[model samples]
Target: MNDRTDAGGNPGPEQPGPEPTGPEHTGQPGQGAADGLARRAAAGFHRTEDGQVDVLRTVGGVRGLAESIVPGVVFLSAFTATQALNPSLVAALAVAAAFTVARLAQRTPLTQALAGLAGVVVCALVARSTGEAKDYYVPGFYTNAAYGTAMLLSIAVRWPFMGLVFGFIRGEGTHWRGDRRRQRAYAAATWAIVAVFAARLAVQLPLYFADQVQALGAARLVMGLPLYAMGLWLAWLISRPVAAAEGPRV
Candidate 1:
């Protein structure tokens, strides 16, 4: 009985010792390493997915909406300031510089610079042509009013184009917002800029028609105050952190 009990307690052919629980229990160290690597990879992928979602959510908010309005306001202000100071080649160069800066801030420096150069050329040609044409040319004040109107109208037409150009230049993935939302925001912002610009012209139109403000220079300075302030305010509003949060991914 003692011999049988001892044999039972001893290792038997049918029963092997309990398997090892240590790292060595695995087939090889490399296998353990591979498993660890896979877990890390999976974790990384999940983190990336979560981060992308957060970015999308932020862009969908009001901040993104405000950010979208900023570049336009900046451009308008730059144009006004440049025109006020130089009124000719210098002003055009200033506008070009402003557009380039705006694009650069959005991360599309080269493309914006090229586009701005093209715009400057076109504007210069138009200005020169009108200046030379007796029929097309009017008093500076009327000319200024007409020019302001034309600019505002152009803003209306080019709002989308500007958005597209800026997006491409900046490598912003694409229009994240739906067409309806984008259009609505753009229209509202563009109209606001135009309205302000037009108001300044309206204030001067009477004086212009009455020959009270002779030089476009005097009218420009007089009307510029309100317009400049309004433009700066608009820019400040657009540059708020909330605005940046609302931009669409692409």
Candidate 2:
């Protein structure tokens, strides 16, 4: 039978379903790499050994939070006070560099620090090239747009991206894709992510186009990590799979 479970709701012998084509589908030839990446991404949600989401660790605790927030704060402050692009950019880069150096000195994993520094450098260069303080946030806009589009496309393909990540978290693996209710739940969660990206553009684009640097900076800060964390929490709540008693059917 094609059902994930037998007619009476007891577990059936595992049988392969028609393989879907997408990053989230385990049927793909690149399934190994894709599953690994999905698991890694899922790990960031801080799913505990007991299946709980650790909000504090998921948001990277206090030090990680500071590293993410402080540079943008410094840049905004410097630009607002001096109205000079170069100094503000330099200050932001300096702060990011300091974080990286501290991470190195402390022998902590440099992944977050190095990534933050790379992002800061990109923003700094973009702003410097345009000689507009507001341009500092442009790269972020593109990033959100790209990620939103990709996730939306995944949903269109019937392989919702959240299912790939959250499935591993829930210990369901790609089998979640076989369950229609689980599929819908995950699709909804992925839409939540798309909404987060869309919200960033909808609110900030006007500010960006009007060249309102300070307000745009504030908006980016408000909408960036904080909004992302909230969205993730909501997704985690909304995407709970159907119970085995109500599991997938043919």
Q: TM-score for all predictions?
A: 0.32, 0.82
TM-score of 1: 0.32
Summarize candidate 2's per-residue lDDT along 1-250 as a digit string, tens digits.
Answer: 0000000000111122122343444456666666665675565455656555555566566675666778889999999999988999999999989999998999987755666677788888898898889888888877777788888999999888888777766656666777688899999999987888888889988999999999988887777666776777788789965456666321
lDDT of each: 0.34, 0.71
Give the least accurate 10-residue stretch of model 1, judged by summed lDDT. 1-10
Model 2 compared with the native: what TM-score?
A: 0.82
lDDT of 1 by residue, 85-165 (tens): 224434444555665566568774243244334434443454456552111112323434454465356455643322232
Residue pairs with backbone overlap in model 2: none
Counted clashes in each candidate structure: 9, 0
Residue 115 lDDT, candidate 1, scale 0-100? 39
Model 1, CA-based lDDT? 0.34
